[model samples]
Target: MLDFAIFAVTFVIILVGAVLYLYPCSRRASGIPGPNPADETDGNLQDIVNKGSLHEFLVGLHQEFGPVASFWFGGRPVVSLGSVETLRQHINPNRTTDSFETMLKSLLGYQSGMGGGAIETMMRKRMYESAIDTSLKKNFPLILKLVEEVVAKWESFPEGQHTPLCAHMLGLAMKTVTQLVLGLRFHDDAKVLGFRKNHDAIWSEIGKGFLDGSLEKSSSRKSQYETALSDMEAQLLSVVQEMRTQQESGTFIDSLLQSNLTERQIMEDSMVFTLAGCVITANLCIWAVHFLSTSELVQEKLYQELDQVLGSDPITLEKIPQLRYCQQVLSETVRTAKLTPLAARLQEVEGKVDQHVIPKETLVIYAMGVILQDANTWKAPYRFDPDRFEEEAAQKSFSLLGFSGKQACPELRFAYTVASILLAALVPRLRLRRLEGQVMEVKSALVATPKDDAWVRVVRRS
Candidate 1:
């Protein structure tokens, strides 16, 4: 009886796989166009892998199949929605849940074990928004302090020397986010170093996880992932305990502690914020600085803006909005760099968006990088021209997807503020020069990172 039960389960699994392979439910239901097979077992797997980057492969699919396309990733269905009209149809109406979040949850096994009702969603939003509000006021001083610290280190380098921008920026971003999330400085914290090591290991693994689910399948990586998660959880619980004794603090964990959330929920959200906050913001800063360094005209404008509006004074929350040019530079950097190349949503119910039928449970992806670079949406979409953003018309051309308007991600909004303050603190005091003839290329990681990390020369302005 036991042998028969095992045989039956295995047979059922094989049967389902065969059925999915034949029908390709995701595309069959929607009438979307994509690769004919859409499954990895097909002979095209090597060809798709040969494209080098998933972003490039998706772009090719969009070009061949038009707006909505479907394909499989290791048996899971993923549909790419590239056009603005198609994106608005799926994302604008379905605002409550995110596809990327669901994907992460699925990978982490969170959905099977954790609570995720409407109340949980509301609590999560409240925590994120509250953290943004607190960080804007409190994290500004910290951003400037970190900026000055970076400058001091740069000055120590002999004239004409260059440094790896990604490494340094990643460190600065980790410190800034660690302070905001944990309510303490991480630069000297030995435990924080351990946390950072585990985080880097896990993140590097995740970048490879996109190709195949080896991060989950491999024993070594799985053990490492679990250990990192355990360490983070233990540390976050400790932070929660310590926050209980403090009278006041603006740390995200402290704010969540004051809320009605259970300790587990708070820890879960803290880990999300910590991981997401560090890499995305670091890439944002690195790319923005890289673009500015390359564009002498833009750098002069930025210097002029900083000199006129701030001129050696401290950057405060009150003064942030007044730095309009800095905001435009950041916006342009995000567009040209395509920092966040994708946004995703899961259609829980059958939905129609602009004549496109989206099947229920479809993992609809917004190919943001493709959309932002669509020639119809902008003049010279590939060019790094911040002045183009001065026009209200240009700003309205591409919705930042999950960064602004009603469907904004609060953490990204907070990132904009943090990055703006970093620029404000540094631009007036330093002249950034891109190393001559070094071409910066992009790769899809947890977020987009330089294919080769950016290197730059920083000289203090006299």
Candidate 2:
């Protein structure tokens, strides 16, 4: 009886020890400060959802835990850095790998060339940058023409007519991006509209499906998403086949064809640029106009700058730089809107930020939304003040966040030029006013957009 009692005691002790080891209640492996896992399996995922969005959750996390914080994403441990000083330490200027590319490719399930060696990656990066640069230079005239078309359409609207701002901006973005990146086939309105429809289907699914694993649960949604993706890919493939037989027009596709990239490579890169470019450009313009409509002083100041600088002369590539205040307004718009709210980097090797060591292969998030709104960094961080960007320090800080200057991604650079032209063309001839009693709620996703149709009324500036 004594032997049996001792054996039973040992068994219970072993079982409890194993259970504790497998399902840790307070696992802080990195010694970083953050909430413990809410469940053994889901980790802090429910916490993320309850907070509304990853950006919002990060804001709260950083607010509570300071600049460097940690959280469990599923079974994986993740670290978030929410300040300029921490970000400066983490971002390596000499690193060739594009963190955004990695995230997008994972979301897209595009595997080719992703695991390439450093030299190959650098080569592809160069090719892509070169192609975008050539396309922008050659297509500058087309960009101006497209902006003029949008301005003309708005101008023709009768006084006090309510304009569907999001729709118009999205359409313009679709047309501009497609024609420049794909080919002249996009000049056909039907083709552009069809492409836009497919794009919307795929993009909406990609945003939602990856977020909550809904794509895996709903077969019909999954089927529709797959179909849309396939259709878009087919359209791109057809364009590639046609471009192969045609003369080079210095378009983005043309530049890629001139290079030694495989057909699949071209298609993948094209899809990335087309999707990212259109969304970023459209949202940037939409928010800029929305903000300008609310502030008469900003609109008037921008118009005065345009009037003084161009004075009836159309804006050219050389003239873009002279519009410094216009750039400031756009910069401020990006900052206030928190346009691209989140960015992430995988720690390829062990890394340290402010005494916390992030283990190799850990997911590191740049909580840009929090940093953008950090009161310590900006004066009255919530205010939409463009003049804040006039300070050299502000510009430096913005650049460090990858919104401007050489640090900005290629898509952002393209958006800036496209937006600058559109604003220059429209702000001078039209006064944008918000429709009364309309509430615009921001929906934060891969890109931030108005939750409903953003409506505005336009008056011809005399």
Candidate 3:
């Protein structure tokens, strides 16, 4: 039996060695993996695909291999392009066949059957829009009005000292997006209690399934998400019914109704708007405050921009455009924080990438976080320097992160509007300071979250 075991081990070792030997090594590039760009895989590479956590592995592999490297993920061809220009061309393919939906379909397991959700379709279209839609446009004041309620709560909290101002970012984001879309504030001493309960029950555990293969693996998790989504749908639909009865003379809902959109489309689109807006805004606010507090000089500079542009007046969407430095600060905040919140895709027939001829069906992905931080493109790639974006060229360089230029999301034109108003509202009334003894970094997930709670204390300016 011992002799048989020894022979079995020897046979396995030899087979593995033979497989590795057959695999091509760096061919085209100087420091990359795979054979030359000429070498193409003749067969499906499932081993590379199913390895899972495929992103982390590919990042490490790319670091060794250099730009334009290829790897396998889920029996599909995956290529990593580190340069910004090349990346821009990769995602904006001239076809509707490739998009965030392909990725969502993968995540939601949206196969041919099961009947897809309207919310998903609405989310995709909104994401594709270059700027805020005509419907959401009317809700400009409502967005800030909702946030003012959240800011009021923070003001009510005890004066001075350390506070978990961190958690409030999410709640603020939730309230702003919720009210903007549904015209309802869902957080308060009473409602916050419920929001927290529902939030924890649903979202807290949603990320855990990301580890063990599919998000569908946990029945409890699947149910929690479904329940949360369904509850949201019900809440929005009820609001729609109420709005229909009142028939507001002028409002976001009124505009939504006037459009030839279906009832189901309204609910789905609003939810999509909520998801799209809430998550990014909250994190940006927290990160901006955290970074600003850490540098008094930078804070002072931002204050100068704020006070000089529209002194003692509430920030309006019209005024936000002229605040260039403040805009730069916000842009720098996004760049430095590297939220890389989501990945984008396009179905370009894959050309030859390293050892593999990217088959037409293979999905192509770009790591926004890593791509944004490329040392070749960014000086002091890891440093937090707002001035880098102060110049036109430097600022233009960041268009890959969706600020301006060809791939720019039109919503970004207004994100500045929202971010500017929020910052202006607080800068005059509060002083933000980062907490001590905490490691500040980013949490890697579907979106980048501040790794630590990112706590700060706010002192109301007298």
Model 2 agreement with the true structure over 167-215: per-residue lDDT tens digits: 8888788898899988676789898878877876776665456455678
Rank all candidate structures by their lDDT, best first, as comma-separated numbers: 2, 1, 3
User: For candidate 2, what's the RMSD?
Assistant: 10.9
Note the residue pairs that clash in candidate 1: none
Residue 167's lDDT within candidate 3 is: 74
Candidate 3 displacement at residue 347 in angstroms:
2.1
* Model 3 clashes, total count: 9
Per-model lDDT: 0.69, 0.79, 0.55
If candidate 3 were superposed on the true structure by all CA atoms, what would the RMSD be?
10.1
Superposed on all Cα atoms, the candidates' RMSDs to the truth, in angstroms, are 7.5, 10.9, 10.1
lDDT of 1 by residue, 278-332 (tens): 7677888889989988888898899899889887787778887898899899888
Worst 10 residues of 2 by lDDT: 1-10
Best by the lDDT measure: 2
Q: In model 2, how many backbone clashes occur?
A: 0
For residue 138, what is the lDDT in candidate 2?
A: 95
lDDT of 3 by residue, 1-462 (tens): 011001111121122222223222222222324323222442223332332233344455557767566553222234556556656455344333223333323333333311335555444454334224543466667767756765676567677667565576666666655555555445354664454455444344333444333457768777887786567667768777777787553334445665555666566555445554555666677777788878777777888888898887777767777888787788777777765433544333445543434444334456666666778777887777788886666776777555555455433444555667777777777777776776676654444566556667777867
Clashes of each: 0, 0, 9
